[model samples]
Target chain A: MSDYNGQAGDGMNWQPGLRESYIFDRNTIEEIRRAASQGIYDIRGFGAKRKLPHFDDLLFLGASMSRYPLEGYRERCDTSVTLGTRFAKKPIELKIPITIAGMSFGALSGQAKEALGRGATMAGTSTTTGDGGMTEEERGHSEILVYQVLPSRYGMNPDDLRRADAIEVVVGQGAKPGGGGMLLGQKISDRVAEMRNLPKGIDQRSACRHPDWTGPDDLEIKIEEIREITDWEKPIYIKIGASRPYYDTQLAVKAGADVIVLDGMQGGTAATQDVFIEHVGLPTLACIREAVEALQEMGMHREVQLIVSGGIRNGADVAKALALGADAVSIGVAAMIALGDNDPAYADDYAKIGSAAGFYDDWHEGKDPAGISTQDPELSKRLDPELGGRRLNNYLRTMTLETQTLARAAGKSDVHNLEPEDLVALTIEAAAMARVPLAGTDWIPGRSKDGF
Target chain B: MTTATDVEVVDLATTPLRELNQRLHDGAAGGPLRWRIVNPNGAHAVAVGVDAPFEIEIEGHTGYYTAGMNKHAHVRVNGNVGVGCGENIMSGTIHITGNASQACAATGRGGLVIVEGDAAARCGISMKGVEIVVKGSIGHMSAFMAQSGALVVCGDAGDSLGDSIYETHIYVRGSVEGLGADCIEKELKEFHREELGRLLTAAGADAKVDEFKRYGSARRLYNFNIDHAGEY
Candidate 1:
């Protein structure tokens, strides 16, 4: 026994339970084993788990010597953002720059969707309907709601289109840019099945491409059709995953979109193959500059609003995105967490389902202990929409307050005024990706800019 | 235009199409039911959002989404129509005397569409509970991913007919260029023949039900099978 547990650096000693390099880590080994045993890849929810260069690698260059900083409490730091002013008769006006990202009624419980709408309305921001289309509960709760026109067009109708404050034409998603949407059999409730016009207890995969149109040229005609239907009252938004952001953005602008939503790899999905979620699309940090460059080249940077999403957690991430030239930022996973999606209170239930409290990602299974993702009546009963709404409102308020604090520290009267000049990256990768200068120096790496 | 009786004339040249649609929508369930639209020269979204059971006649060619989101209205297009004719309809019928562009009767929930001439690509795509009859040939990928509907094509079908279809009954009279992934020819039994015959009769098409072949989903790709992942 003593020999089996030999100490490190001991000569001629047999080591027990030794592991391979971190490159072939435990999670990787587990995934491979699971795939091999099941004869299928793992499907899960949430964003990319692997670490990448994120907003944490960049820091605000707070006002000093030559710059002037506003007093924290006394000075006002406005955080308002307006979306879709380019073509729509009524552009959405928000009290904060952070909006709620689209999360479908099927992917989430009805209570959760209603709570999100309530919270967003309370925060004076907007919420969006996901692939499954608009629910009456969400519509009643949300003051300003953007309806998504996905490839599937599940539950889509002209009445709902006209009822929407804005319309988002979802060309692709961040988790799987080229991939279609998947709602497992377990998640398809009777109501959801009826809404989507699919059979109950069958795994539904949405179309990867639009049924009518093929390319961007055809897409322009489709957009015109939508505009004609809505009488140009609603702002038409084009959302694309962060693959070929520059080209996609330019195409979206040329298609006469009032807004563009660029989602990065870090964005959450309800259910998708782990491979697609991890391997597809660019990181949020790397995609923003290219998207902004497209808008700048077209001379429509601020004219056609750009909303950045994927991996937005807190005020710092929002400020960083806005600083990188995003008109607004949208959040999904963070909002779910705020609504008690992975609460530790359900740790015992989570363990029963073969997942831990914080690591639970089986959203497609419809066995969510926290009541946010599950369609099961007993499980959904666990969440109180009013309480969840309050929690989300609190979270939104905190993010807004923190953003204002940071803007004041940077001497920006408005949150949108915090530009790339006030930011520096701690790493070369981040510097190159964010197109900002390196800290303690003046080098942007890729291009020759004034900062260098 | 001369012999038609008991009709309300709406000239697109004089009144805006939106205003006409608004008036049509404002009328109650059993109000004035016959309307004749004149001079609709390739205009888009003409006579949209009609909920009542009105009988509307478009005299000439129209652009995209002619008579879209129609409910209970009997809309007749005398000439060729562009993309998405009678899209997302709820009830009633739409008859096109001439050809229809891509995605005719797309995502329609109820009602019937009769294309007297050829229909282009993706006709009846994602159609739900609607019945469409095409007298002439259908282009590529017709009825692609149709959820619940019946598309009866009197003539030949182009490539990849009923690709990724879902529960929709397709009856093609002539040859099919190819079958799409997971879409295959199904046994045309007596019940299917009767269904096709009824649909044809409703659309006033002069095609025999026995001459057509049926196509549907094989149900192989319904679930997330690892073997099928590559095809997707």
Candidate 2:
């Protein structure tokens, strides 16, 4: 018999010479070309675009004949969450569990910052500040704001510290855990420069660690200093990228954190090396149980509230996070999307930037057509804060309703009532990471099969 | 918390360090303009984040982050200090009579910190707008990545001086072990000499301007470039 191989194109039979490399695929080839031409690593905005095991890997079993369900229409499913109850004199009380994650005014438009604040306020949740110091517009619009203390210490001051409702000491971000923040020269506007106390139009690389302190012991003193600075009123949250969740969680708790904000690999960034963003940190689902176990081992599960972030998309993700032991969930990219990022309406404008609407993530370029990520005056004016805020509020409400529907179906009167027993994993990898039973089977892969 | 007002000193040995800091902060807006902190006994974050215009003196030793983020307070420590003394000070002064450990005046912005004794590594590291003067020598990595400030060392400087330095000015009277990447000796013009003289007067260090050499950023690495990888 004559040897014959089929010709290949898009999804066609693989041809001999035209076969794609498993190691160096077409996308990989393009990246190589880009690196060869530019002589620099790929620096881009947004989180890891690669697919990872996320909340979708897990599913909830609805109440059946054996387990009774609650009446969805008439019954109530509570969504309220309280954080920072362990230490702060004034703990954050939220109407919903979902909050707006810190997106810097330098990374986003001032209008966008205002919009996020307005939306969070309308939803009765808290909004957070980012690398750049507090903006008047941001503080004025949001009733409750969490000020972030970063490695750079750019515009860190006492007035802003006292003004903040809470203080989050950022150890690392999910996008680049061990790496520092990178702000391209392109995004450094006059206002952004003034806030960061750097020269305008200079590429800024922030520190990877704090200048003054290091380690858990030093962190305890640092936390105390901030508490003293703020008169022990505001909650001090330790936000860390999920690399060693068990050890990091223990260290953060030991460091005197009122709350722990854990971010997974799917978290977004304003700007960072593409390689670092995709390579570092654990996925959100993989991190939760380890963190929960650590907190539980320390007998501080609910005492020190846990807020999970990174890759949170829909109400399903929120419910799954809560089910896995997170007290609350924070959103960044989703909130940006709700603020008109990557919308089909701006498809033509995105094309001008050499991208499609949903495909555009060059936030570091500061040429966002949606006006949410850009610092340009003309581009930023496109977004009216009031309208954007209303849209975000609508999205938050929709998510809350979806969560409530699922919770009622699961017979959970309070959203926090859902537990891991109600969950089943679709994949073995997920079953192992989430420590949940495989669907239609009681096997959790790593755990003993014995029921006792 | 012991408040012995008769001696005009707040004793940290008897008073909780937290209460002392709280008093320092709560009184900053409208508290005592001047006070003495006795028996500091190496307490961390003593007199930190004081916003009000006050003059406080610490009698003994201190631990990490002493007078950190000081806004409007003038604090003086009679004895030695641990790591990160006068970190992130803003519009105030921190004077240490004895030696200081690592990261002295780290990230200080718009304040003056004078260490009579030598400072360990990373003095004035990432300094913003603060002015620091050291009577004795400074350890290695001094003024690394300093953004905007002035670091004056009356004695010698250790290795890797001003590595990856920014706009901050450095003046050293004694020998320099080595200059770090992108750091070069600049001409000590009349302008710099006069500024050095002023800083010297502030630190109370008696050093001739003619004996000192100045160093600053070459500014080559202000923006990223592949050719400058060796420098980084």
List per-prediction Cα lDDT, in the order shown. 0.88, 0.89
- Residue pairs clashing in model 1 are none
Name the runs in model 1 displaced over 4 angstroms.
Answer: A1-19, A449-452, B1-34, B188-194, B227-232
Docking class of 1: medium
Q: Write the per-residue lDDT of candidate 1 for residues B1-232, one digit (tens) a residue.
A: 3223467788999988767766676653445678989999898888777767788999999998888888788999999999888888878899999999999998888899999999999999988888999999999988888889799999999998888787899999999999887899999998898899899888888878778889998988777778787755
lDDT for each residue of candidate 1 in A384-408, tens digit (9 for 90 to 100): 9899989999999999988888888
Question: Which portions of model 2 miss their true places by more than 4 Å?
Answer: A1-19, A449-452, B1-7, B29-31
> Estimated TM-score per prediction?
0.93, 0.95
Stretch of 10 with least lDDT, candidate 2 chain A: A1-10
Clash number by candidate, in order = 0, 0
Candidate closest to the true structure, highest DockQ: 2
Q: Judge candidate 2 against the unseen true structure and give its global Cα lDDT, from 0 to 1.
A: 0.89
